[model samples]
Target chain A: MTTMADRTDATTTVPTEKLTLARALTLGMRTALRHDPSVLLMGEDIGRLGGVFRVTDGLQAEFGPDRVVDTPLAESGIVGTAIGLAMRGYRPVCEIQFDGFVFPAFDQITTMLAKLHARSLGRITVPVVIRIPYGGGIGAVEHHSESPEVLFAHTAGLRVVSPATPADAYTMIQEAIASPDPVIFLEPKGRYWDKAEVALTPYGTPGAGLDKARVVRPGADLTVVAYGPTVHTALRAAEVAAEEGTSLEVIDLRTISPLDHDTVVESVRGTGRCVVVHEAAVSHGVGAEVAARVTEECFFELEAPVLRVGGYHTPYPPSRLEHHYLPSVDRLLDAVDRAMAV
Target chain B: MTQPDVLDTVQLLTPEGTRVADHRYDPRVAHLDPAALRELYADMVLTRRFDTEATALQRQGELGLFTPSLGQEGAQVGSAHALAPQDYVFPAYREHGVLHVRGLDLTDVLKQFRGVDHGGWDPAEHRVHLFTLVVGAHPLHAVGYAMGVQRDGDVATGDPNRDTAVIAYFGDGATSQGDVSEALTFAAVNQAPVVFFVQNNQWAISVPTSGQTRVPLVQRGVGFGIPSVQVDGNDPLACYAVTAEALDRARNGGGPTFIEAVTYRMGAHTTSDDPLRYRDAAEVAAWRAKDPIDRLRRYLADAGELPQQFLDDLDARAEELAVHVRDTVHAMTPPPAESMFDHVYATPHSLVDAERAWFRDYESALEDGSVR
Candidate 1:
């Protein structure tokens, strides 16, 4: 990377940019809005209030009220009407204000938005995008930080995507907007402010294949599959393992609906051991799915059982306890260590 | 503006073919034609027949569950019919009667409860919003859509033909939701052309209306600055007249008006719940006397619009619809298992895709490893 304030040198050509991941998201949204006429954003306090996190700052003024709508303080109203507006050919993007507040719209997403296409036998498609900032890290009060993506993943007829990097966030968001199916785009709030260089392009230009999983780090000793905020944590654990000469593999599963099994299976086959980590509770969490898939695809190749490290089956812990609740660099490497021992 | 709706509440022709006229509600012969009354009576009978049939099927294990609207038929059908072709309707889950009026097929409505589909109708094509499972949420959607329609210059605006209004139907328990109150406030302030239809069928699951509110629920409308009224929900004509006028004024730029249809729950909340635990038989019997269909049938027969043959044909027609619905439910093939992971988000997701693949594998293994 080229020289920058945060990391003066990492590579030759690419520059180490010093911008918060949240600002990158804001800029990416602004660019997407300016680039496409169909793109419109609506949510509570997202207009004049500039959103609770100010991620939507200056968007209403730039896009105007009609495009950047300040909807009534009703989550169900926001989603149900977005389905109506989507029918009218407006590419309406909705924000749930917070993760806990999204349940009111769950019926609309799981039942209406999800099944509209399948029930209509593919005649009607709901391209509406729902954005929820998820995962606990910040000291924000309860109800603001939750990982409800697992529930959405259980729903039929909906796609769930969470981006862990500013680079993926910039692209995946535009991809979500352009998708024909309803997409639940969960932003890893814990990683929102961390900086990275993001490659920007025209909105709706799908970069990562809609269903393919991405391998964040290539290794041989063990494969660690993780998503959302946990992906970064897994990568950090991989760094620790590298110092110990363990050569750990890391996969960032950006998509949750149609599993990108080819990439995941490929990585698992390369590495003899496997572990899946997530912020969602482990009991029937996304990790359970990944572990089962790895067992199915690479049973004989796996020298160890498919292990999972995740949050406890309880409410997301308080901020002071979140560090303990969340799968950390140490816990992940420990899971990796256990897998290697097997 | 401080008083109740000045319009009449019709109470004519009981089940025994007798007519009664009161000071406030003189039966509106002006609005009713011979054919209209007969059709109205037929609508009520057939919908109730369908409701009863669905409940029986649920009990027999033919369907998953049923939310019965046995007593609220008149309130739903009457108010739904009042809408112009352009006006939109937003309904709570127990709105079989309204869906029937809006021409949604029985097969589609049943698919929802059968767990075969999330919902089976397109809101845009039918000019109705989705059946909101979340209590009281649809009113906000109805009102917001009305605001949109108004912004599009589609309100009644004293030009009767050009006005468009929205009707939101929810139950008494749903009124406790903050969304319901917020919807009324927004509709009132923006003067959105919308009507709030609350079918106070009394019990919200185990909780009675008394537990929720001390005042008449209709009066709560005035607190929000929206005019309000309480009507005998079992009276078909009263429900029709009140809803029609409210929709009329809404279309004519008269902001929002709340109509509280005072009715009783003749059946349990759903197939799973036992109402006997909470309600007494005496209360159910008292309300049974004011049954909406019997009174409408009496009015029609007395007016010479309904014949004995009409009653027989109605019975045959109801049974025919029931049989047809039953066949559709049983015939519905379980949607493909992968169909579960297909529609969570509007866009394809890497995380969801991975999980779906994972579930698909485990499911396949559980069923038989050979199945793809």
Candidate 2:
């Protein structure tokens, strides 16, 4: 009998039949609209304009004006009114247009949307999904490239999700739209054009639900955990480590919330060490949580302390300094060596 | 007999209570009967009682802070009572009277103030939305709701049942916000069924109305092409009449109207504020002379609507309400620390998930000093 792994991942994986992260997201959103009648796509210039990135380019023609709404240029209005629509039984997916522009909506999201469900004692479920293209890479001017996940992660009653691979992007978005709770789907603009082989089968049938994590590459030496653009860097570093006879395990944490901790713990349990990485600053970033959790879950199982390799404690640097800002192949390889030494 | 009515700025019977009336523009006030007048009085007093009790609890370290609507009672209740059962209300932080009139429990307001929760009532249940601490954001919500009402086949023609008007309540300071202007423009252009109610309570936390606006506020609403009206907000009768008329017009598919309810602030802006530091004593005294509750009581007595026993009974009822509110506030308990991690996401967060795990290690380390 052919094993499940051989039958699915390695043998079934095809490179040419792949989708870009942006295209995958577009396809996933289109599929959701086709399925759920209540699902609406609304934001500044999302209708006839098709979004600043063309992420919603053809949606208006397919779904019509009411569902694919073009709202006034007000972020707070978009989010605040989306809450009202959710109250009236519409699954509103709001687009904040840009990262810097999202601040106007912060009060509504943090003070209102995040607390709406709990304040109602779960009597009312506000299942709004706010899609914001976040993080820096395009050498864009101020505000457009901020990694503001920490501000929102601190807020209760919200779900945060980000996808690094085209496959995960395709599947996680549909899952976020179908989710019962409010979700902030942060799409990495820097990785939108990046492509990878994405299995067309439903995630559970082919992989896991959007909320769960996936071990993209398996090994036994040490675990490297990362999400978004950093996942590619981790994979590249693993290849170099393999040449040196080091077996490094790699994990792609697609969902920022409800982390697939069991997988990380299992990896650490097997390898006896771990490395956490992200594009966000190391202080209070996603890796900090991973380091803490691995330390707690597999403290005895861990031979060395859980190490984090990420952006330094500062604003996203100029393009010249981005090489230093991001966790590069050298950075990931360095972290791997450190973990093994530990 | 020395009557306070002639000299009072806070006249209970007005739209020209001094009887110096310009008949064409003067509003009608005879609609309020003995029972209606009494009900309005009870609502104002009870709301004030609720406000005082909440503030006392906050001072006793039970709440984070309190936003008192002490002097704006007549405006809140007057407009709230005028609203139809189907008409919606969007309020700013100081709408404690609106909450009381709509039957929202005092504890619901406390949830937001105490930092225990954001808001504690169903907006659909009361047609009273959560109090917006962020200025002027909710008017757009009201405008959008009105737009939704328009899309729901609930506007135009002469059908009363086909129209559902939305009422947005804000303060003088909120008038300066971009969201408020955007809301007004949308309401006007769509001819959306909405009521823009601005409670000009003399001060926006020490910055008086003069600093906020150059023109009369009601006239400012008119610039957006919305029909505007000014009311003697200290007079409950005037408030009820003006709000009722505006709501009726909007419900009849007449589009949006703006009402600037000119009123005063009887107390400091909030628990952490001191009004004496900001404004002169004479100005505060001048506003006090127009106190809505006291003037209403004088009218009630002059009209033979109240016996001596009714006064005593009301006092006892207000005190009882105050005690109940105090006890409920004191009864509030802190939520478990895990609940913070629990509600952050509808789905679990990997970062939160990981951090929660890390926190566990720190907690355990503190407990037994086993994990370094």
Question: Which model scores highest in DockQ?
Answer: 2
Q: How many Å off is the CA of B171 in candidate 1?
A: 2.4
- All DockQ scores: 0.21, 0.28
Can you write out model 1's per-residue Cα lDDT over A1-342, one digit (the tens) per residue? Answer: 111123223344533355666776777678668866656888899999888877888999988887788887878767876775565456678988889999988766776777767555455677788999998888778887788988988887777888888888776776677677788889898888888776555444446745667888989888888888988898888888999999988899888776677788888888878899988888988888878878888988889998899889888877888889888899888888888887
List, residue by residue over B1-372, the lDDT tens digit for candidate 2. Answer: 222111222233642223234342245456667788788889999999988888888898888899988888989888888776777888888988888888888677887777776666778898887765788878877876776676566665557554677889999999998778878876777677889889999899989999999977877777877878887778776677677777877887788888888898888899999998889989878877777777777777777888777778889999988887877777777676555565455445556676688787788787797875
Fnat of all models, as shown: 0.27, 0.36
Model 2 chain A lDDT-worst window of ten: A1-10
TM-score of 1: 0.79
